[model samples]
Target: MAKQALGPIRRSFAPWDDPEAKPLIHFRGVTKRYGDFTAVDGIDLPIYEREFHALLGPSGCGKTTLMRMLAGFEEPTEGDVLLDGASLKGVPPYRRPVNMMFQSYALFPHMSVEKNVAFGLKQDGMAKSEIADRVAEMLTLVRLQDFAKRKPHQLSGGQRQRVALARSLAKKPRVLLLDEPLGALDKKLREATQFELTDLQVDLGMTFLIVTHDQEEAMTVADRIAVMDQGVIRQVATPAEIYEQPASRYVADFIGDINILEGRLEKGANGISRLVVPEDGLVVETDQPVESDAQNAWYAIRPEKLRVSLDQPADIAVNTVSGEIWDIAYLGDVSIYHVKLDNGTIMRATTANTTRLVERPISWDDRVWLTWDRNAGVVLTS
Candidate 1:
């Protein structure tokens, strides 16, 4: 199903770039160890107020350990965790001004939706009237006010997740930590909920830190994503920057479908750099400055950025490769074509299917030329 229409996902908040803006949460040289295994390496990270930050990594990459540290469930072996300029060293999970929503809904199956949302408020010794008011507000915020009387078993997965969200937000915590909150939902619901989560975070003006292995979910909802691997952060940037200008080869391949070519950078006559790959005898001129002293580089290009043509273009010196169509996967919106070079290396390219039911422009075993602009590829040294 197509995604539900939602508000623009542009990043309206950029506190990280502002020098005067104070960090709402700071992890100073944070490290966590379980027995002899290091879960989180010594790393420093700061999250700004009211920003939706995502910790994205594969399983066993320490993303959850970081989130647990923030929520006070697990303490870091080294460094201090400061929330709003105050240390959260000894604060218990319940005492800390943060709420967490686990992958499981954790809703009360026997209780009504309203009661489930009001449970935390009542635990704080809030008056009955205030508890009702907060519960009503949270339900309305999650669009579940009409189902306040329904039990957890009576609602759908999405609804139950919303109830869990309402409960987590009812206490008005300083930050909300989510651990794979949408992992229980189906694909369509998960995609729709991503927009809703972003909208809710913006509407509530609350700080949200989510731990997720889903790359597309992070790109859709977060203002910034910290890509982690092997107990250390690889790169932290906006979704576009992280996808387009990956800091390393691992990050480029992890974020999306990427085609990487092992190449060598030749000495430049002017400021422009030239990288040559001997496998396909391809040389590309790039305006991007290469460091004076560097070795072992690779060219990274997204499949969508490459253009395929029936004949070779004039610019054979750079960014041009002709290969036979080795494979083709025709997705509804776009077609992925695998072009095999002379060196038996297959490179993937995607073309948009703009017309409905048109003749196949290019077919299997047809020779085609693939080319990209000078700046279309990123040079990765590490």
Candidate 2:
């Protein structure tokens, strides 16, 4: 099969030279409700120009509601939704300088790919010549030029998704809103599309706001993520910051797998605090000062940061506990070992699978010691 060629890159008329560039999208105490139930509550957020922002959370967390309000499909009950310093209070979805790619990829099965992409331009009353040029450019940009004659039923899932993306981008909107753009594709295709989406956003230099429940997908594609729950924003930060330094137990548990241990903080003479886990009788030192009452505290640790071995290290002086390996799982790239302590508390440790042999240095039911550096764990006050 001959590969489709992307047309010559057109210069974007997007404004980038303004030193005092206002935010592309701004929400001030924005609240949305459906009669008796509140879908989004008092959200205050700002998305900069050309930035890829993701609203990530589980089901019923108000992420979709927030996106709808921004797209002007739903009106806010309380505050304002602003775009490019203009209030979008009464603007309809069609009038707003934004476009949304629905999760269903809403392509007409009877229409060809080129017609599907050209639909939006035709709706805007664009000239025939201009629509043709734009549609051809968008088809080429998505690498779907060769499939322009094919109907939606004849295209693969990924190709249909690209067609939807091309249609959304054809209008040259100031912002693009995506609702679970990759939810329909398989895992491998989803990963590939994420990179392609990131590249497209950069090349077009348009602000992209994505709402997705997939944490890994958000982390992979977003420049920054806003973790939402119960119609409230939990934490907004870069992917690295959100993963490494979670603000609360909910944020810590939601982003990735973590081991949270309840403990009490003990103050020492050196002005440092030590967390004492009552159940495991393990003491963990922390660099954060204990400013509040040390009665109740929690320690969060990632499984990958922990090290497990058959013999305890004599030189180390940190959190160490001996346990018996309860289960083992080989995941190709890494191996997961579930260790049960004497107190019946199970802790997880992940080790790299470097060798191909079934039997290794450690096996299930082996006596092992789990240890981690003091600074590796984070202390959660809440």
Candidate 3:
């Protein structure tokens, strides 16, 4: 099924850009250490109210550790975790106004869907009638009202995941923490569920903090992403900013398929700079250049931005290179061409397969010219 866009409401939501906006959740110099190893280094971050934030990184990168600290499962070795202007120090997990949904779904084997969703309310000593009402509301919200009587084992993986989500939302926590919520689903199901999850979040108007290692998952569902590496946050920005104008090479390479070539910077007028990559025999131009006195820099461009053509480019002075197609990968909707340049550098280019494969113009071992506009790439001095 096709999905609708988040529209102007979410598109215009940028409370972080407002100076007077107070953060709903704040990590003030937070750190977590395990004997000889540091899991989460000293860090400061803020999550706004009703915002969908993602902590994205590889394994052992402290994304989970940081989320655990926020959920009150682990105490911060150094700083404090604050929620709504109050310190959460010594607050127990169950007592705090936060709910966590684990990756495994963690549903009870014998309990029905309704029972699982109503369990938390019952634990808090809510009335039986109120629990029933809340469970029904939650089931309807997750579109599982008809399956309320089914056991966890009776439901499919996607259905079980929805039950877990309903249970997590039953108590209505101020902030919902999801630890790799969709990691168990198949690729197609996971991609479809990403849109559904986004829609659900928008409907509830709740603050969601999801910890994920999948870059595409983070990019698709998060309002902002914090890229972590070695217990340190490398960069935090919107998906477009993170992809188009990464603060460092690590972030640029970590988020997507980008070609980063080492080069020496040559300054030019009007904020344009030329990067002479001697080792790759290429000269790339970037329209956006930050104030950096370092002469050595890196030029980064995504595969989708590079255009592949059989004829030589009109302007070969910059942002153009001649290469031979070493390999081609047809990915249904698009094709990836691995073009080996004259200097033996494998540059990848992505082209949309708008027509049938039989009508394709470029083929294997074909000599091609790759070109991009001056503004298509970014210059990184780090």
Candidate 4:
């Protein structure tokens, strides 16, 4: 099959030099409503040009609704949606300088791949020669040149999806919107396509906006992610930033597996604050100072950060606890140990499975020690 053809490189309008310039796509208090229910509740965001931004959240989190509004399929009840500093209030989907790839791969079964791809251009009344050239280029770009004569039914699922992508890109829109683009593919194919899409985005240098509920997928592909919930954006940052330093307890728990320890703040003599987990009889020292009145707090620690051993390490400074192993799961790469602490609290720790044997250094029901550096745990106030 001929690979998809590359379109002419289009210069981006991103103003990296000017510090005061507005973003490429701006949502100024954008909101959408259906009767009493509000799908998007006054969201304000700025998407820079050439950014692979992902709208990540669970189903019914208003991500799809927000994307539809941006595509001009649904109008916002209030606020403005701006593209390239211009308002999108009166623009229709066909007239807008953007194209959307539907999650269903919405290709017509009766039409050949080439004809399907050329449908949009023909509707715009382009010359036959020009449409043929663009269609040929798009087929090659997507690696479907040989499949141009094949109908949608004769192609594989992945090929059909590529056809949809080619059709969407044939118009060369300013922005490309993908709605769960990889949702239909199998696990192995989805993983392969993720990188392929990322490479395509970088090569094309087009601003791409993807909506998905898969956290791992978003982390893998997006330059930055907007974690949304209940129609509100919880946090917006790079994947690493969002994972390492979440804004709140909800965010901390939602993004990944975290061990949260509830504790009370205690004032120390040196202006440093300590957390007292009375239940665990554990005292964790933190460099961050806390207010005297802030009694309730949580210490968030990733499972991998906790060090597990049969005996406590002498070099440990603070935040150490003794527990008995309750369960052990031997995943090929790592072993997940669930330990019941002396305080009756359960804590999870992951250890590397170095050898290929059934025997474990620490078996279930064995007493073990869990220790971590104070700095490794983040203090969550909210």
Instruction: List clash counts for every candidate, in order.
Output: 0, 0, 0, 9
lDDT of 1 by residue, 166-237 (tens): 999999999999999999999999999998898788777789999999999999999999999999999999
Model with the higher lDDT, candidate 1 or 3: 3
Count backbone clashes in candidate 1: 0
Error (Å) of candidate 3 at residue 154 is: 1.9
lDDT preference between candidates 1 and 2, better one: 1
For candidate 2, the lDDT comes to 0.87
TM-scores of the candidates in the order shown: 0.95, 0.92, 0.95, 0.91
Regions of candidate 3 where Cα sits further than 4 Å from its true position? 1-5
State how far residue 26 of model 1 sits from its true place (Å).
Answer: 0.8
Which pairs in model 1 have colliding backbones?
none
Which regions of candidate 2 are displaced past 4 Å? 1-21, 269-271
lDDT (tens digit, per residue) of candidate 4 on 207-229: 89999999989988887889998
All models, RMSD in angstroms: 2.8, 4.4, 2.1, 3.9
Error (Å) of candidate 4 at residue 49 is 0.3
Q: Cα deviation in Å at residue 45, candidate 4? A: 0.9
Candidate 1 is scored at a TM of 0.95
Off by more than 4 A, model 1: 1-12
